[model samples]
Target: MKTNRLKKSLLGITLSVSLFVSISIMGAPQAAHAATANTTTTAASTSVSGKAGSIIALGKNYLGVRYNFGAQKGVTSSFDCSSFTQYVYGKNGISLPRSSQAQSQVGSYVPRNQLQPGDLVFFYSPIHHVGIYIGNGKIMHTYGSPGVTISDMNSGWWSTHYKTARRVIK
Candidate 1:
């Protein structure tokens, strides 16, 4: 009788320990999952903030480089209208196509009134010219008088040739 009782008692203890371990194993992952989620949220937020700051910094850095014709491929000293836009955004970690026409195809279409910093403001009928929106109804581009300068959207030249604006940044 004692032996049978001892066996039952041992079995009960072993079963209880197994259940406890199982519950702990399952519960541990939930805590870990919560921690992982928190980490991911923080990383995403930091990445977005970093990107916005980088874009603005890039815009400020390449303010006055001269415009070059057919100069969209490499990071040369001077930049054409399209090249200037590509270089500024590229420096901010965004890769754009070589031509303004090509770059315009990507991202959401932004209306003139909705323009923001880092947005690509396109111009000309054939879509040959492009510039970076620098807020306040002004765009930064290479004009004949100044290589890279800010001009109002309502400026006579830009107003006539204004095609579209696109937002490539998230």
Candidate 2:
């Protein structure tokens, strides 16, 4: 009985050591890879967000510039929604098309819930207007009275007019 008990005890210890060794060898690399992957993802997101901030900052410089229905591109005195986005993004080395409809087709389509700052948000059923999302559900855009101003995207007129969003930076 004593010898059998001793053998069982030895077997249990051997199994435990084997498990520990396997986990230490195999699990270590996987854990390390996961950590590295997480770091890479965070870094990429930070870089993208930083670019977004720069774009937003540039756009805000033209606040109250005045809105024009057919405002020419590269004009700073007055801007239509599409021209404002094109000019601001162009200044940051990101080229956007001349019109809002054309601009919408250039970037990756991003859902409203996944919108980030600097995203080009479009409105109207067939897509007529565009704005740059400035986070907190607000967009910086040019309209009738508030040219190059920030407005909430989640309430009032904007809420019902929400159409789609696009990510041009990434």
By TM-score, how accurate is candidate 1?
0.64
| Backbone Cα, N, C clashes tallied per candidate | 1, 0
List residue ranges in candidate 1 displaced over 4 A: 1-53
Candidate 1 structure quality by residue, lDDT tens digits, 79-153: 788777776677556888888899889889998878766688899888988887655566767756478777777
**Which regions of candidate 2 are displaced past 4 Å?**
1-49
TM-scores for the candidates: 0.64, 0.71
Cα lDDT, all candidates: 0.68, 0.79
Instruction: Residues 15-123, candidate 2: write the lDDT tens digits.
Output: 8897787457544543443344222122123322355766676676677889999999876778999999998788767999998899889889998899878799999
Best by TM-score: 2
Clashing pairs in 2: none
Candidate that scores best on lDDT: 2
Query: Candidate 1 at 108: error in angstroms?
Result: 1.3
